[model samples]
Target chain A: MDDGISHNNNNNQILCPIKPIRCIVKLGGAAITCKNEIEKMNEESLEKVSSQLRQAMISGLSSVKICGMDWSKRPGNSEASPTVDDFSDQSLLDSDRFIVVHGAGSFGHFQASKSGVHKGGLNQPLVKAGFVATRISVTTLNLEIVRALAREGIPSIGMSPFSCGWLTCERNVASADVSMVAKAIDSGFVPVLHGDAVLDEAQDCTILSGDVIIRHLAAQLKPEYVVFLITVAAHDTTGGMVTKIWEAAMIAKLGIDVYIVKAATDDSLRALRGELKGNNVPEEWLGTVIRLLR
Target chain B: MDDGISHNNNNNQILCPIKPIRCIVKLGGAAITCKNEIEKMNEESLEKVSSQLRQAMISGLSSVKICGMDWSKRPGNSEASPTVDDFSDQSLLDSDRFIVVHGAGSFGHFQASKSGVHKGGLNQPLVKAGFVATRISVTTLNLEIVRALAREGIPSIGMSPFSCGWLTCERNVASADVSMVAKAIDSGFVPVLHGDAVLDEAQDCTILSGDVIIRHLAAQLKPEYVVFLITVAAHDTTGGMVTKIWEAAMIAKLGIDVYIVKAATDDSLRALRGELKGNNVPEEWLGTVIRLLR
Candidate 1:
């Protein structure tokens, strides 16, 4: 079937579709953290998701990356630090062919602010408490996720942005060892990365968003599709319309064809079948925006 | 923590309340033929039984054999057959140091009878259809048990009574290669055996009871206990009382203690814990009987 690759009858070189959509399923933090939203994660639902993914894999889909974000009560501010404790089943992020990155909303935001790190930009002094708490949170979440995946018959390893020696300044991250991620994927395990305040040369450290991590990943992998199962629908009919618009604009700037679809519950089985109807992101558009040199 | 074993500080030779019982649990042919029982098998119940047996093994108990009877119903005898099928999780069976022998109750009991094998004994005059059906039935059930055990993380291997050279004559199994059973137990795997007609030198060929195979096993092993978990309690209190009497008397004659305890539901939980308490031939009387052997 259509594997997003065109073959020339005359020659053997397979022509891959520009921006070949490798599926990156970004599970919004709210999807797993909200009590009501995550209530449907029973055995049957998990089995159904597993079956669907197995089918996708069997269909020659190269790989699938599922990422989750840490949720906090604080909202509408990118500067709010995220932590790993807010998420469950973090091990789902660990796969050789998959890359999982999480947000640090609960683990570091308040700690960083208390250390007076958030007041100044990346140039601000490094707050030891905030840094230690961030590391602890990431390590704890990563361990839990790895154990869970092992129980489910999948072996996974964890990686940290801090361990990679990236400079973190305020809410922005710079100069990450992105090649390690590529190496992890090549080795057949899903590498998990998440939003974190990283050490930066220009600025002391910056907060990175789960969204930005996805963009960086898409640029490197040139995946066939990047599916973001977000908590909010594509159109923010709710009063937070301005925030939605800004989020959409930022994602578009990444030059990746992005589908902004509402998250699906277990009851809505159709979504699992890839039969979602509300919105569509065309492959051609994503190809024009995200340019992959390799 | 109390593993049912007591140690005498003076002599270091382990002292156990329950002597190492090397008894064969001869599963009745009627039990395996029951459909309702097989469906009741689940992970929870299987775990309970397996854990109990694991406890027993940890207690330093040695050699428990589980045997199934091949009791294919005669056309008219279907109503009289037991309604429960084998419910033990093969995985649990694999964990314990045990052996399994099954009966062909539904395999060819009727056809063998029609071919005059049941009456005149297993001779060439018997119809091949019945013999083949019996073999197939036993093979199928054995394989199913093996597969089920594998799923429960238990490694199991299958051995057939017929293939192992169990010969019969005139409905009497006079000889068998019982060494294979010992070898399986010695190697730390549960040996599976079933009841069937076997070649006999004097009687030509004979139909054997699972109970009889177990008796032969007890004589060889001289275990501490002999426990049977049949579909119906040992000896229908009414008509088949003779079978019970003969079993007890023969066991007593062998100079070994015999405990005829009724099993509930073939659920390993009840069987392993010895909780089905309608009747119990206690150790005191059993010891006395063994003394009579001298």
Candidate 2:
């Protein structure tokens, strides 16, 4: 009669809670790749973003260490950057606990679309070939991004969905086990995930979009903020900016703020640093934000 | 005071049990790569092994589907292959439910040894660089193996220990959460794991050897048997054949038989097909088996 749902809830209640996740960052595939060129990475942009991430983590999380704050709950939007007084009081609640999810722009989209892999039919050899090709491409990028982050002293690990039982039903996410991601974060490592080709219940196999992954993580992890570092290209694959914005809006309904900023820009760093507001962006910062209205 | 160990036991009990694992196969790094050369894979050997795996699965496990056997426990060493009458009785207790774990071989040894990454000191930037280089080399090879297996219609998923919660303390495995591996197996995927560099509590980090991993998995999963597809070379940075045999001997103490066979050989295929025996090697069979002397 329980159907195991209540059993899982009972399981969760008894376990020690993980570090409160502060942000879920989405890196658009177009932002880090030469979209028109097949399998070409935008190295300069990637390096810039990595450096910014390092800076953001140091500035944001250092305060928590200095203050030795008990981060049980996420801070409200009203909270400002920590000051010396805040550190002394030890009430300042902020930490750079975030997960990075990236897209598979030029890395995988070509093979996926060409083979019609998104539709899924594993019996067909072409579809299977496409799945392998797509995974190789996307996982290559995931490892590259993880290596770049590691160079910046970030303990980043690549977690591929297909390798971790992430499944979809007719292009919709049917089941995604985020327990490993949660454990990775709890053990003091940044988890880097990517869009991947996964098995489907109905179609046999299909593409599991990174946008869908972000939304699912937001719902499950309840991060305080979600950041989208994207660059829209004229010719794009995998639904481009429209799908990202739509996903962002859906996540906003959960009362978490969402920032859409161009990658490698100061605006991206600003969003990461918790500076840019939903409706009050200055001319200098080029970005948009989504927030739920009370 | 409870250390939450009992709580995890309670959590596991409610979850659905996975299929009984018939085997845990180890593809030695030396067997799959040109150990003398840095970062080179032996493509021919890899292809042969992959094809053999496909054959073994089809031949050994196909009867289970036809007989519709309920596999609650692994078959004992005395049981032979299923027969026609066995199928009619619907009491065949054999299935090809197995997991693959490979080694780094020529892939990661050079970088890992060059930087002395086996002894960890994370503060040293050089150590971090070595970790990155080592991961790139090994993960590159892991992807190649996964792709090879995929080509053979084996649903292989590469699960890196570092990406999950596998940790070591002073080079001994302190904690390894095989929950993801179990989930992958339950969901009908052959989880492909590899020797990896992991975080160490005593040392800043250390290499978690494939030999150690095999022992841990055998102790935890209690598979019916284990097969080591290995090649003993003149030099091995990670203890070579001696360590493998010691690990196999240790596993044998748990009532699980282990076979040490030459990679890509007919004996290797026979070992996988459950044909080889301990201390009774035929002239054609080029392998050694370690079995507890009950």
Per-candidate DockQ vs. reference: 0.01, 0.11
DockQ of 1: 0.01
- CA lDDT for candidate 2: 0.71
lDDT of 1 by residue, B198-293 (tens): 434564444565666676666655554555544443433112446645765676677655444333333433344443233453443211121233
What is the lDDT for A198 in model 2?
Answer: 83
Each model's backbone clash number: 94, 0
Model 2, span B8-112: residue lDDT tens: 532232222255677889998988888776667798999899878867765654434332111111124242322335334333222257789999988877768
Cα lDDT, all candidates: 0.40, 0.71
Off by over 4 Å in 1: A1-294, B1-21, B35-96, B120-126, B233-241, B265-294
lDDT of 1 at A76: 48
Q: In DockQ, how does model 2 score against the reference complex?
A: 0.11
Docking class of 1: incorrect
The CA lDDT at B181 in model 1 is 47
